[model samples]
Target: MSIPRDTRATVTEFLDRLAAGDPDRVAELFAEPVDWQLSWPDEGHPAIPWIRPRSTRAEVADHFRALAEHHVPERNATTVSAIVVEGGNAVLLGRIGQTARATGRSYTAMFALHLTVENGLITRYHIYEDSLSVAAALTAAPTG
Candidate 1:
């Protein structure tokens, strides 16, 4: 099934803004008090600084900022293989490769992102990723 025009547009804009690596611009596409959810334990893993609760658009920007700070910009890569849309929802299936700056370890993980848009703004942002791989990469000892 085809996606609605407005939802498709919003998703496209979000992808563009995310690619540009502008946290503020990326957050601009989201509505205030977004329903943010990530696939991780509730104990709040301290290894990954970006893993935190985000509600407001400003917090959304902060999430991206923290992510950028912890990961190597030159080594990070994201590939979206598919996007399935229905009504106001869209799910992006992709793989992400990232290198931890401190540990200098790299990990590749498959990810699925579910987004829900309302009135041209994203109201929900839920991501399911290989958190174990990411955590290992971030916390592992740096190799010589």
Candidate 2:
């Protein structure tokens, strides 16, 4: 007999698939009408054009594409400091490191991610990261 998976399991599975970086594969995980937002300061960096409020699964996928195009990520593994999940809600605490394409300067920042999974699709996603550090890295001179 096969049992249905819970929200937490569904989320983990979806994230695991996304880790492969197949945009088409990940897009299948979102509900048609999804609410997504990558929260940051009002003065958003144009250099990182992928960060924005989105209301559809396509936009969510576009956000991923944007990051892939704008940042040259280092080989270092992303560190997940913490993860909290309850029912359909989850919060991820992690840090990421990447080099901004425009400035070619390294940027590292901690982030808190909020995710909501229902049935088996992502319904809500709100991620918060340090925007000031990103902007500075994009604007400041490269370190010698």
Candidate 3:
């Protein structure tokens, strides 16, 4: 199925809101009871277990909030490189740069966000990023 123009617009608008640091606008793009998953490449363990999936908008919001609180004093800055929409799905390739308030560390990492839209709202999303780099930035030794 091909993506509808309106759906594409919605996806673009959502990304714009995210890049603009407007959480409320971002929330408006999500369908009620949204499912969000954040996955990282695990180098350890036999199964290489990834972080548990998060379902529900509130849970997703809390996850993002925690990440923001850990990384940025106010909010993390997101930069989008490209967006591809097909059917009810959209793929966003981007980079995120932030300075951790607690550790005063800086980090920049690439990310890919896959989203599923239903009724002009995002119902499901999966975020992939360089977890190790992000962790290091958020927990590294402070620089003078």
Candidate 4:
């Protein structure tokens, strides 16, 4: 579906800020008391459990900051392949491939960001990705 011009612009600008690794800009895209939900398939269970919760901009910033400190890669390296907007919601498909600075381990994974915007600011964000791929990338091989 075609997105409204204003919504499209807002989504694009928000993504640009995130890809640029500008935390302040990212925060600006979000409304106060934003809701953030991140989910992945469970590693050791039959059920595909989903992790859902709400968070504020400051909380989201801390999460991103931790990732940045662990991964120390080029800020603009993330690639957004597509964006589909429906009503007040937009879904962004993207991926990041980089080597972690702390462990010098290479990692690549795909991601989907589901966002809800209101009044030109994001109110909700739901992120989905491959948990196993992320775990493999982040964890060091067992030293026996």
Which pairs of residues collide in candidate 2?
none
1 or 3: which has the higher TM-score?
Answer: 1
Clashes of 3: 0
lDDT of 3 by residue, 38-125 (tens): 7654333221122445555555555555555566645556678998888888898999888877677877889999998887778888
lDDT winner between 1 and 4, please give it. Answer: 1
Candidates in descending lDDT order: 1, 2, 3, 4
lDDT of 1 by residue, 1-144 (tens): 122248888899889888888998888888888999999976658888788888999999999988899988999788999999899999999999989998999999999999999988899999999999999999999967
Q: Write the per-residue lDDT of candidate 4 for residues 77-117, one digit (tens) a residue.
A: 56789999898899999887765554566777788999888
Better of 3 and 4 by TM-score: 4
Write candidate 2's Cα lDDT for 1-144 as tens digits: 121257777667666755676665666777778877777655556766776666776777787777766666554345678779898888989987777776678778888988888777788888888877777877777556
- Which candidate leads in TM-score? 1
Q: State TM-scores per candidate.
A: 0.94, 0.83, 0.75, 0.77
Weakest 10 consecutive residues of candidate 4 by summed lDDT: 42-51
Q: In candidate 2, where is summed lDDT lowest over 10 consecutive residues?
A: 1-10
lDDT of each: 0.90, 0.72, 0.69, 0.68
